[model samples]
Target: MNRGRQLFGTDGIRGIAGEFPLDPASVYAFGRALGRWLKQQTDQPRVLLGMDTRESSPTLVMQVAAGLRREQARPIFAGVITTPGVAWLTRTMGFDAGVVVSASHNPYRDNGLKVFGPDGFKLPDQAEQELEGAILELRQAEPQPLTQLEPLAPQSSLTDAYLEWLYSHGPQLDGMKIVVDAGHGAASQLAPRLLTELGATVHSIGCEPDGRNINAGYGALFPERAQQEVLQTGAQLGVSFDGDGDRAIFTCSTGRIVDGDAVLWLCARWYLEEGWIANPARVVVGTVMSNFALEKALAERGIRLVRAPVGDKYVLEEMLRHGAILGGEPSGHVIFLRLATTGDGLLTLLQVLRRVAATGDDLATLVRDYRPYPQHLINVRFQNRPQLDNNPAIQSVVEQAERKLAGRGRLVVRVSGTEPVVRIMVEAESEQLAVSTCEEVANAIRSAIESG
Candidate 1:
């Protein structure tokens, strides 16, 4: 395992916008490092930059852009765009690389820098390591004042090209009433407009971003509001996107929550039925956090379920390894590798909506077959980084907990890649058992970590 990668987490270099890795000096160095690396790949590299609606995003963009400019590389601005938007534009528009100045689903005070290659895929592990080394060396030297570069304006043509590409893949929905929740983040301005242009009657929520309000009361994780809005608006579907718009969640017209697992099953079923997949026995990729019943449903259809680590990147890697077209996380990061290089919430919703129109069935009816096992999740915060997957104290408690399950259920204890917390998930046939085991494991984890 490449534990040497401390700077880059599962997603990217994430932190409070003004702290350590995200600080003005460090952020600038990061940009310079990325620029220098791009220079090595090509002369006068054209790097695409985009950001979320966070108050910190603009400053970070300027810092990174200054750093890129210092390295004699050009930064093309795609201001206030989704993460996938930058990736798609980078690959399709002949840019050497892309960088996003938003932390997906993180609060407005927090931010990150995610780098993508020309193919719209994230930089591989080795590439990030090289950049991190450069960033560190640059940061250790005398901190130079951030340069005030010329103001950058977003190229409207780039945005139009991306929207056109996405629209081309989606089936038009004429007269379909829809509810849109953009989480007051990257999709705040784009999602509602896109849906309206697709011929849907759009009722938008969470569209007002006040710099600090992104994900405060609205996002993919908060479905209650979308559920209520769906019921009240009498819309056929309700979609909620995350802070960066790469993840999404859905609610049915009946206010029923149709989460990522249901999305997976729905897509798998469509692929199998349409013979889009050569054999029904193909595999679908999911994370360890995926519901066990998702595995069973796929198995019943002669399809195999492969579990990757709990990250969209890991799920994408597994998809590539297995040649799978479909993969997703329970947190709403669904990747249709056939269409997109990453998990695009907008694209995923479009595909699901297309499926709905094709089948003439609502979300509830389409996902009625996926009965998930009882699941309980508990997150334990730490004063410092809590040890896991290797610490003996934690391992002992986990071993005891697994024995308690005795093959009747599953247990997953993992550290959060984005936050300083350890999450415990317990799954069983009964909710009571799931909850109790989860509490037991949570207490053990807390005690073990605290005692040390």
Candidate 2:
């Protein structure tokens, strides 16, 4: 057994398929731990399990079901569903917890496990820590044979429930022309069907998931494909969803990509205009990576934009803290807190389409005033992540860059949580300056880290 803190990450336990931590044995153990946790909460606890269209998903699902049955918990399988679908079903079906076996936006070879509470929110940090501790403690004990567990039945049909919820909860997108790119992942099967059923003329690409093709050269991570498809299809707008369909990217009719910052700005404007958001100030939460234009645009409308760290969790936290209703990331992870706890790419897409339909304006025209400033970002790979504030040389370079940009631009530098890389970002009045400044700052960071 591994000692100290387990390998759980900010989202959940994730790794390359058939690799350590994500291997069958470890996944089975994780399932057992998850089941045990729920069993302790209530007798005969139920959990909804969902997965993306990854090749290895079936093996892991079966292992998880076996583990759950070992703990005497009921496991309801919602096969090949999106992450948000699992969360929605968990709350709607009154399950004790929801588990999704997918690595959102990651390559097909990689997989992940994310657990959400009955309220459809990701497990709190402390809850994850406790769960990791429990797994570690259980690992130290003797392992039980798989044959000892009773055979569990797979109960499906949560997808229909999720579809029903989508149609009823939010406004319909009738008579709209929308293009949806499912990234060949979890939403490949459901997103198009739901949108078409909601009365939209849907043009879809990347909807055929053969397991290996999930998120391969498509999806929200790469919106260029969807953008081109939208332009070719002459659709009103386009939505690109990540592997598990928890994040979304958009494209206008002109093949121009509109990221999360722009999407949130548009949504905020629509919400304020329709009085859908109760907050008079029209509070919206965004990450540090959000373009300066978003803040400026919202400020122009008497709306206050709250900046959070570069993660949906932090964005949601800030939203809840300030009683805000909308929040998201620049990477297309838009969260409509009033509708869903976590980011739901499909839900966000539907909401945007509703806005377009209601206003009778093309998506491009609707977002014309929300143009993002030219932003440049450079990643500096390091042997280890160092405290940038503690490094005087790096700090001096940042200050110099900031002073140079002055009121015309912004600078942000931080280490990535999921990778050993330092990100240097700069936004300015011109694209050249943004790129040049980012390079200068990145060079300084590389030099500082190398010197130390």
Candidate 3:
């Protein structure tokens, strides 16, 4: 519930790059604030910096590094790397903090900044609020000339280290035909090569980054492209990663899209059967956006589902608090708390493949039981967002919808953390009911905005 943050959003400060909050001045101030905070924690604290393949990433890194140098903090450069790669390195390499310059699934024209603590997780809200205060104070301060900034070469050894770790730990995909769509982002090189080395027949698309093409008609946002490829090639499976490689969506051999909910079910069943879970019936953490059918299926198996607010960080928090090992979002941000501190597309994909290989089941067959309820979601853009909970008209409309559903459905309405929009979701036993209920709620919100 923390408020009054001017720059930092739920997923970190994101916007069209070279604009407010991402321009040279604001970015440098943010870096300086972060460097000072690290210095406060410990003198000479080291920070690991990584970025995706956006054309502006290199310059942004240089500007941020310049600010870090001012506070005597060491910045280790990891160029063109995935978001989770920075998080993993931060924990393994013992850096005080890690910074990833990526907008994730956002288009190339946009960019963002995400910070991982020494524990390799996103910063807690209190810490982020404190950092935001410092950043705003420094916003008006003088900015160093971009031309005067020196380019920092990537630590080639660190990249090699990450690759080695993946090879040593991840499952071998031998004899499998897998198609990977990197979305022309951070995983452009690593994903295809890693799968090939693991003995999989790898076919790669969207691996070429022209800097401007990241997430262009590919990746999680456009999984249909990967589905088409899977069908055309008759591949055993297909995976598509977001711009920063933190999340992924999969396509089964039958061209069925397997989202995070299905993946969670697959992993939960695997761990339960494998006797890997310490507690079999405690809870599996997921967002409110998770399909209601997932909850029902798990309940039939004596498993409980705990719904956290949207965001992988919130899911991770609930996992830690509840001591649950499995949790993720439907958007393919799966978190294996035992393996990683954040959502990792590559790790999740490999784990799914490993489970398939071990269970001797096709991906589609394995997830056949996860027949999701007919859910409809709509996003309505607004110029100024008002608190829906405080609006009597919106609340009344929602209450009416709830009574109509009468325990046969669910409704979720909230503001987008990253964009200026309100999201409405409805899930029911029938698509007609779901779509009609969802539209009613959306229209109410739209009317509220218009009236305001």
Candidate 4:
């Protein structure tokens, strides 16, 4: 078997389903490896398996569970559930681990496997590396024949339990008008029901999942659709959730986009005023891609904005390390560690809505004064990998840009983690300066790679 990755990524094992890592054989091997690890940790490990609305998800879940059963671990199926639901259930139900069988925000043709610990957090680096080694070893051993695996059904009770939990924890919306785009993923069913139960007049779109349209121009990636619906329906606000429902993007009544930064800012301030957060100045975590303007604004509020590497897991790590209650990414993954273990689109939307209701401020008024600084990002695809920081020419250009910006802005040049490209980002006081500075660094990288 080709061990290009031993099959793992920032989130988990993600790829086009039926391909190498997600293929039947490899997925089974991954299951056995995970099961074996669980057995080693405890005598009889019970695993909770959840999946989104993707067509291929059921097959993959069955195969993975079959592998787990082979190793004597019991697999509990939570069908058509969100990723955060899986995580939360794993922790609350006292399962050994949780597995999500959907790729967050990816196209319908692609799927992924994400494992969460008993504490409802993503597995740490060491555990993932160990699992990768075990999978490789199992692959090298004698091949086991694939079995006709059938998952345990009767899922209504578990689904109801989850819904009850959501309703009990959330406040009543009373007379709010909101537009929700489910992105045709896991949240298609739950988003609307939750809002309606809370007494909100919910206008739903992108809630129909026909197997192959999970993220086809819907969800957080295309907030314009939600914005249009909100305007047409005269809704007070709009919310769009990505595939798997781990992230969400919002649109205000005035057609303004309310991203993760805005959500975090609003939530942080609310938590402080409500006495939910004891330390308002402790820390607020964001990724490197977070806006510099957000950092400055939070600083003025006596809160510190700490930048982590560009991933929700990294943001969570920073949050845990610094004892921060609010952390999120610009792409709409907001982590309220006190309420939910992982990022939850439904949870985030409710939290934001709670703030709006409590403060009696319109969505537009809440974010009108907080403007993001001018920022530019360029992705330069390359044929070969090269060390960007070590290249003298690239370094010279970066240093020159730094001098020009001085204390007014910042720059970030790094290779993409999931693609064969280098990302160049620059933030400054003006759009023109940000774009020019970003291009200078990108050009240096392009020239060095082309010549070599």
Candidate 5:
């Protein structure tokens, strides 16, 4: 195995079903290595396993449980739970660790394994490296016999505890008309039930996971459907969750999509006003993609805006490091660190509703505090991500564009980490200018790549 490339990404090990990293044998070995690591940490350690609604989840869970049993570790099965739920349960129940079988916003044909420590945080880098090393070694060693493997009885009710906790602490949604797009994924099983139980007049879409269509153009990644539904139904608000329920996007009654930056801004303002966040130096962590208006707004309120890398995980790390209570990405993974370890889409929606109820202001009015400058983004596919900045032609064009825009706009260009494409982003005072500038920069980048 080419160890580093076999599995793992910015998040965890993920890939298509039957592929190298996600293959049953590799998954089983991962579980066994994880089990051995747990055993070394504590005698008779217990680990919690949760999975989404992906078709491959059940089989993978069984294989992982078998590996845990082989190492004499106990496995508590939490069926059809969200990724965040697994982390929350592991911390709440005092489990040695937690394992979630999910691909998180990826299609149903894909699956992944994410491990959480007892504190409900992702395993530290060093710990993950150690686990990977052990797994690589185990793969090289003699295989264990199938019949010799011990399998523990599956355990349920993990979602029950998670729901109970959510109800106990989250705001009540009574009298609110809400629409939920579960993206036919993990949240399909929990979101509708939770909303209804909380007294919201719930209208649901994308709640039916057919084992193949998760995140297929209906969730946060594709919010137009949910936005139209919100407008057509005249609902108070619309919320959409990604495949694994780790991220969320919202639509107001007027059908305007509210992203993570807007959501975080609204929540931070509410928390500050309610005295929930008492620190004078309270900061809100965001990413480079966040709108500049957000930083200005936070600064006006004496709240610091800290910028982290693109991923929600990186935002969370910055929040934890700075003792900030709120953080998120533009992709709609809002993290209220005081409430949960990871991003909880349902939790965030509830909080937004609670804010609306308390203030008696319409969603549109509340979210209008910051007017996002006109921005345009273009993605250019490339055989290889070209070093655009190192090329003098591209650099000169970028410099000329910046000088032309002066202080009235900004430009950012980079290769996407998640795909083989170069992205060009321009924010300007005028939409036309933003669009024109972005096109010009994209052309420059394309020419540079071709020449190189």
Candidate 6:
């Protein structure tokens, strides 16, 4: 066992299925650990369990449940539901905790566990550290072999209940032409149905999930497929959802991609124009990954942009901290704090459509005024780990680069949370300046890491 190693990342515990962290022993231990913690919360702990369409998800869920059962805790299964659905059900349907057994955008071979508390929010880092400590201790006393685990059939009522609640917040879509790509993940069945039920002429893609096809050549990460579908179908707009349906990317009728920043600007403008707040602070939350264009646009409208760390969890934290109603990431996860606990592709699309419908403007028409600032990104890979924030040499290099910026734009250098690389982003007044500045930072980082 890898003792003293970190088990949880920004999202949750993730790795290649059947490996150390996700192996049977560790997963079972994780369940027992979570169960033990839940026991401290209440006498009878009922955990809501959900997973994406991964071949490995069922066994993992079984292992977790069995572990929980061993600790006298109950695991309430909501089989093959979206991540947000589990969160919603956990908060609204009275569960002590919620566990999502799927890697949001990873391949079939990879999987993860995301835990949510009673408030439909992901457990904080301190709580995750506590769970990791418990798991590490319990893994030494691994249990015996388990019995046969059968396939799970979801209670249709549970999924239907989620859709019903989502529909309640959606506007009418009568005779509206749209394209939906569910990425063959958890939303494969739900996205199309929701659009159809709302009276939209829907052209669907990526709705077939064979357990291994989730996020393969589809989803928000690959919006090209959805864009092609939209162009071919001649639909008014297209929406592509990542696996687990937590995030979404959109395509205009013109086949141009509408990312999260555009969605934010559109939504923020609409919210203020429609009197969502009386003399509202008009604070919108964005991640460090957000384009500088968004910041400038919001500032021009007297709206303040507060940049949080990389994760959507952190974004929500900032939203709650500032009491802001809207926040999101460029990766297509937009959080409408008032409507959904976390980011919901469906909820975001509904809000975007409401904005467009209210203004009688097309997606392209609405985003035309928001020009993108020139930004360049460079990913520098290293042999050893790079503690970007803690490394004095790296920090010095970064500070020098910041001085070069001269307040014209922004520069962000951080280790990629999900990959083994350092991402350097530079946003400047010109594309040449952005590219040069980003390259300068990337080279300096390489030198610093190599020398150190």
Local accuracy by lDDT, each model: 0.88, 0.84, 0.89, 0.87, 0.83, 0.87
Off by over 4 Å in 4: 1-5, 142-147, 151-154, 381-386, 418-421, 443-452
Ranking by lDDT: 3, 1, 6, 4, 2, 5
Model 2 residue 450 distance off true place after TM-score fit, in angstroms: 5.8
Q: Which 10 consecutive positions of candidate 4 have the poorest summed lDDT?
A: 1-10
Clashing pairs in 5: none
> How would you encode candidate 1's per-residue C-alpha lDDT over 1-452 as one tens digit per residue?
23656579889899999888898889989988999998888998999999999998988998999899989999999989899898889888999999999889877888999999999999888898999999999988837656565668888888788888888877788979988888999998788878878888898999999889998889897988888999998999999999999988999988888888889999999999987655334999999999999998898888899999988889999988888899999999999888888888899889998898899898889988788899999999997777676678778878987888886789998888888889999999899999998998898889878887
Global Cα lDDT for candidate 2: 0.84
Ranking according to TM-score, highest score first: 1, 3, 4, 6, 2, 5
Against the true structure, candidate 6 reaches a TM-score of: 0.92
Give the Å shift of residue 370 in candidate 3: 1.3
Question: Ten residues in a row with the worst lDDT in model 2?
Answer: 142-151
Number of clashes recorded per candidate = 0, 0, 0, 0, 0, 0
Off by over 4 Å in 3: 143-147
Question: Candidate 6, which segments miss by more than 4 Å at Cα?
Answer: 1-5, 143-151, 278-281, 389-400, 443-452
TM-score of 3: 0.96
Q: How do the predictions measure up, each by TM-score?
A: 0.97, 0.92, 0.96, 0.93, 0.90, 0.92
- Candidate 5 is scored at a TM of 0.90
The deviation in Å at residue 284 for candidate 3 is 0.8
> Better model by TM-score, 2 or 4?
4
Q: Is candidate 5 or candidate 6 better by lDDT?
A: 6
Candidate 2 structure, TM-score to reference: 0.92
